[model samples]
Target: MATAGGGNAHMVFRRYLDAVGLQGLASAEAAGLHTSEWYALSLITLEGSLSSGELASRTGLTTGATTRLIDRLERAGYARRAADPHDRRRVI
Candidate 1:
């Protein structure tokens, strides 16, 4: 049996999830992008800029998936990849 506080916490968590899902859906639709793309864009915006590895870790996506996501964003004009200034071998 769950306590009232536990039930309330569950409700709050559910509502938060719903709100976040709706916002992500709406934003993706507005941008003519997939939800994952929008999510990646949001992460990039929050982080300013991140390398593919960093993005993968942050988003829980594999490196290959992150590469594809970045490719999509770049093709859609939502993102760009640039060489890291300090590290010639890295991209950001």
Candidate 2:
């Protein structure tokens, strides 16, 4: 996307993001995962563990949607809920 003299920086960056998003979708599809599931899994993997509310906040999903997402992942054998240990009321 760069031209002879460092050209089209904005367009180049936009295109790069678009390509990456498409690739993520394709890879998730190949793995039989929804795009949101794939992204949440990536976040969880990176963090090791986090609470359900945190997942909802980070993913910009409503609490209900996040819960449903977790349910799906659990059914698929990809995720599980665990107690926070520090907070009995919290699910991680």
Candidate 3:
């Protein structure tokens, strides 16, 4: 059904999501990152940094997969992990 504004919510949301995805793809190409990696990078940049577990949760990936993603990103020199100052067990 269409919303009061004459737009179908689902269609509108899908368009907005698609536009964002396209923009991400373009940005990823420019930055030499995979599209999924770019999305992760965007989240990291938006929040300065986050723990691997947090990143995994946000990206809807397994922690192991997220670790692999981080490894790739690190090797590409796009990101690095550091021990959190207040907590040595955590990577930031």
Candidate 4:
């Protein structure tokens, strides 16, 4: 017996996800960054500067990955690590 499930549903869901992911990637490239770097930057830019640990928490990225992303941003001259006037030991 054939099931009554919808065949096109999966295609529609996948298309939606792909479309959103591609759009985000395109936006990242246009902003002078690798698509993989976009989420970190977007979080920082929208939420204001944050310590690497805090950024990692907000982005669901590990500390090391967040650090690497920050390094790339610095190397690209898109961002820089600054001393938090109140806490000279931390990069802001």
Lowest summed-lDDT stretch of 10 residues in model 4? Answer: 1-10
Per-model lDDT: 0.91, 0.92, 0.89, 0.85
Q: Tell how far residue 70 is off in model 4, in angstroms.
A: 0.6
Better of 1 and 3 by lDDT: 1
Q: What is the C-alpha RMSD of each candidate to the true structure, in Å?
A: 2.5, 3.5, 3.4, 3.7
- For each candidate, give its TM-score against the true structure: 0.83, 0.85, 0.79, 0.71
**Quick one: best TM-score, which candidate?**
2
lDDT of 4 by residue, 19-40 (tens): 9999999999898888768888
Ranking 2 against 4 by lDDT, winner: 2
Candidate 3's error at 39, in angstroms? 0.8
Give the alpha carbon lDDT tens digit for every residue of 1-92 in model 2. Answer: 34566458866987999999999999899989999999999999999888888999999999999999999999999999999899889889
Candidate number that wins on TM-score, 1 or 2: 2
Tens digit of per-residue lDDT, candidate 3, span 56-89: 9999989998999999899999999999998999
Ranking by TM-score: 2, 1, 3, 4
Off by over 4 Å in 4: 1-18
Residue 4 lDDT in candidate 2: 62
Tell me the spans in candidate 3 whose CA falls farther than 4 Å from its real position. Answer: 1-16
Question: Where does model 1 exceed 4 Å of error?
Answer: 1-5
* True lDDT of residue 32, candidate 1: 92
